[model samples]
Target chain A: MTTPTSGNPRAGGGPDATGKHGRAGERGGAGRGREGDHPGQPGGAPRSLATRQAELVEALTRAKPVPEGFDAVKVAAARVALLRKRAGEVARQWPMLAAGFGDRWKASFSSWAATQPTQGSLRDGWDFARDLDGRGELPAIAGAELAEREARWSYDGSAAPRTRRGPAVRSAAGTFAVQVAGHVRIVRLSYAGTRSRKPST
Target chain B: MGAAVAVAETAYGVGIGWRPEISGFVAGLPGLRFAEVVAESVHAHGDLPDGLPALLDRGVAVVPHGVRLSLGGAEPVDPARVTHLATVAARLRAPLVSEHIAFVRAAGVEAGHLLPIPRSFEAVDAVVANVARTTAELPVPLALEPIAALFDWPDDELSEADFLTEILDRTGALLLLDVANVYANARNRGEDPLDLLNKLPLDRVAYVHVAGGAEHQGLYHDTHTDAVPQEVLDLVTELCARHRPPALILERDGDYPPAPELTAELDAIAAAAGYPAITT
Candidate 1:
């Protein structure tokens, strides 16, 4: 895996390459690498690696322009793969939400999350359900799941959700949920075609 | 990192990654010696997952493997994550803790999956510094696992071997080598996985990971949800021929099959590594 290189700093380098190695390379590369010249650094102090990392993260998660010198095709591929993985994680957290779309879960989640930087799976699923709710596209079962979560916790789309201290009731689509003393009980079970079955909380 | 301490020497043999979904299967492994749990999934202050306590009660090694450390992130590793990992390790009484040499988040954004760092000196430094921060808080030895990436950073300034070796050397951390990753990266890049096995610091490998993957649109992904390809098991054989790692664990994240199927994969890894099967 060690490809011979010309040891040029800007190109790639290797263990046996001529440019730098060992202790000096660690110090010099860490302190004076090209990333040190990034525009976000202050006072011309060695540019923090944080700035370049932020740019890369932006490109990957926010659908921002790929950073210079990166292969657009590969970046796009990575982005798609990342979205797929996120979809899986969110699906695990919101099983019914995913089941609501069934075959379309991966595609639907990927498309929706392309521009959404993850707020973790819990919030990602919640936000997605709310978006569908606003659009009148949420399925009953998933809507019920969302209604339960909303009744139990207070999520403002910013910060982690906090437990509601008081009793709360919420509904979505045709499903209804009530939270008493932090314990949620679903009352109406019209979601997922379970209307005929007696609602079991 | 704090002062380097002597690492525990133990033979873990064949093991599996513990998930609640497949806990029953993992627990039933008759000769299992060690297992790994996702660090973030466990609660530090609460009871261990169902089968995990039984495994621990039988004196099995349950290593806390952290998936979200983002040790390669350019920013300082998050202290809260480090503390939680340390807590999990202490609770499990693990001999070692493992995390990836990749970043999962940056720029105040979560990537939700392991992302590769450039094979550049800058990245090496970032990883080394962050590893130092994490090791300082950990109660046990830390092993770093290199992730399989679908794409390489265009600004990479080193080869895979050099990048990984440099990080291991600087941090003095053990390697949690993934034979599946070696196969995935090599197959994706058209290189020989054996070449990497030859160049790596094999003695430093504390354990190994053998997972499954599938090809999608011409790229082989280390999905861990597919069956372990024969190609990867062959590489395990190749790696063992050079320097057998202390343990080899089967990693199956999702799309779990029946218990017999999972046992067969574990047995296959044991056979490939020339270790005794735990499934008996």
Candidate 2:
């Protein structure tokens, strides 16, 4: 209930039921802002491959086994290598906090990530890749594009990166390239285009 | 020129919608009459807030309302956001400009919400030829507004008030009438908000948006947030007693209530549209 630029969505607390008014109480949504280190700003809404596979299956169910090289792209590059060491104080204070309603709070976080669900764990061990991305329905992006670009639409690719390149790069692929280290925008689709993507489903 | 859209049958009631988050409470709200402003929050508020057009020449009236006019986008209406909202509705002499029958650019991406188009006749002849070529290059009375969809029309052909009365009877323009988005789509599709206000066409309403909706966990959210719901002030007091609206606004983006509770829900929508208290 604050004013002069508050955008309240009930000052961010309740509202995560996932529709039929689970919480369209919608106030300037589009969040992200926690991974702060530097040029790592991405959050103005985009989290749901079921909240990053229930945060990687509750951090792999508090486990400690596979230590030899710890993969999943080295745990998302140790969760974005501390925002690339605070990229020079977020490029000297991100254009004076880009005067709020950053596109209506990133368009109320893609209508609150399209009333969630495709399976959760926002990740711990990624519930066996969140039940194989809720039995193969993954791919709803928020921002992350690769292979010759053009994508940015998101509701949640969770913390992105599912497949990387072509030669049928798995998650049930037909074609999809990556080019970049990973602004990965696959959304598991396979209408068969990026020259038939395949590697191992 | 998109084709021609000047349907100005005199701009109508409680208009003031000027966002930049309420340009300093519309410069301390004294005799506010009409406003639509926005034009991308006044070109991202780079200027034009110092006594906005001398407070719209002390009678308000302002207009220029565009918010990423993807006018059913595919790549045709962003000529630099319609030449910066036709130079801010011709430096604000705006008699009736408007937008949002929905579409906020796609394929080039910018879904800052307001998508839902598909009613068909090729999406109402591509939003009536892009609002008749953007009202022939920003020629006012462009009104549009109606939004409140979760997602429907994967096709029914028409009936979002006959595809907005066939895009205002094939582009003549006008109708910002968002009585809380037609009571948030007849209470989210259960229908009968006066039978979708008797299948719309309230004499081609010119302006009268009255916001504030939120219920959410019950599926309400037209989210202008609290106040303005004695059934949306009896449906804007029955569309100002059947469209006599010439200007009327009480929008509030989120709780800032007490402008005497939005002038007592706009004096109970002008005493259920008996009108009288004309004190602007």
Candidate 3:
């Protein structure tokens, strides 16, 4: 349940990262007109809905404390639900990585992604797989999958991945992959004793 | 009472959300006149996904359902996302497009899924403004759906019906009502699903979503991966008894059942809504 002190660098780089035009003020003004209609923060100037929404989003996605006046237990449930939903999405993008963990995929992905706001499923799976490889915990079958993706796309862990225009070759664990003209071929080098071990069907 | 907008009047009977995994099963459905595709999945240019062109070729009316417009976000909706939706609508020749009333991201951080907004006037204004910006660029009508939220904001100032009505009243947008969402929210909050249905403007329903969910830790999660429970189907029957929407769409996001199970689900929706069975 540890929160990453620094959030994912690629946290919000998708279509959702559109420039923030100064429309918050305009919307705030509209809300200000009806400030007296509701009664919760009755003392000073009312907090704008935009600001409130941003706080809620931060709490939900960043493992920050649940915002004041909200149900802590329900927000906790929502946070868990979001992580589970995200795991399912990443599993779709990286099927082999998910299959590599067998029945533990949901639990593993959920825990790893608990503090990470999604950069989209593709990058999320990539990041998760790379993290597993760093710890020597990545399943060998998933290593082949990771190797193929590395050969096909060039990702710097801080930006959106781009397809490789020229030929590329990459290796991960005991797997090797080569990509030329957008076609990727993976080769898994199995050890003598590990050759017979197969993932549960 | 709002601006004059196109209403969904076509009698598109039992429908399903088209996914790549079940493309063959969906294409094989003999009577499916309506289908919805995630707007983000289709490219604005270039080639459509496999089987999408064939679905379009078969004259199935596809509606682009957007998951990232973040209409309920307090910030202005992204123009590029709107344009992408519009372009996809034009490419698919879709009758209309739909997005959630919930926000997916805020303050440049993606929630990765729909998040509920407060049921307050300010939140309503945000949705209305975003919907205006979106519909201005849309080539067809836009339907806004209320999401099934796990929690309600503490500052909610309006009832669910009132909040949804106000947004719809201002935007003049059609409603993409999800019956499963209605059941989930009501079951979670211990309210009657039929009560909300009684208060909502049923005539504005552009279409209906019927999905499955399972209860987790005393809360009903509207996970489309599960089978459509009998309670959800019963609600569908109740919805049709009051006023049948033009279409009732079966949405299965993951854990896609075998073809026969999927066909049976579609048939069940057809049975509930009194629409002709599309599984033949």
Which numbered prediction scores highest in DockQ against the true structure? 3
Candidate 1: stretches off by over 4 Å: A1-48, A183-185, A189-201, B1-8
In terms of lDDT, model 1 sits at 0.79
On the 0 to 100 scale, the lDDT of residue B213 in model 1 is 96
Worst 10-residue lDDT window for candidate 1 chain A reads: A1-10
lDDT of 3 by residue, B51-123 (tens): 8888889899999999889999998998988988999999999988999999988777788789999999888
Residues B203-257, candidate 1: write the lDDT tens digits. Answer: 8888999999999888898999999999999999989899888789999998999
- The CAPRI quality class of candidate 3 comes to acceptable
Candidate 1 residue-wise lDDT, A1-201, digit = tens = 111111111111111112121121222343343443433344435445565566667778889877655667777888998898889878887889999999999999999999888766766887899999889899876876787778877777765565678888898866777877766667665535332222222
Better of 2 and 3 by DockQ: 3
In terms of docking quality, how is candidate 1 classified? acceptable
Better of 1 and 2 by lDDT: 1
Ranking by DockQ: 3, 1, 2
User: A75, model 1: CA deviation in Å?
Assistant: 1.9
Model 2 chain B worst lDDT run, 10 consecutive residues: B1-10
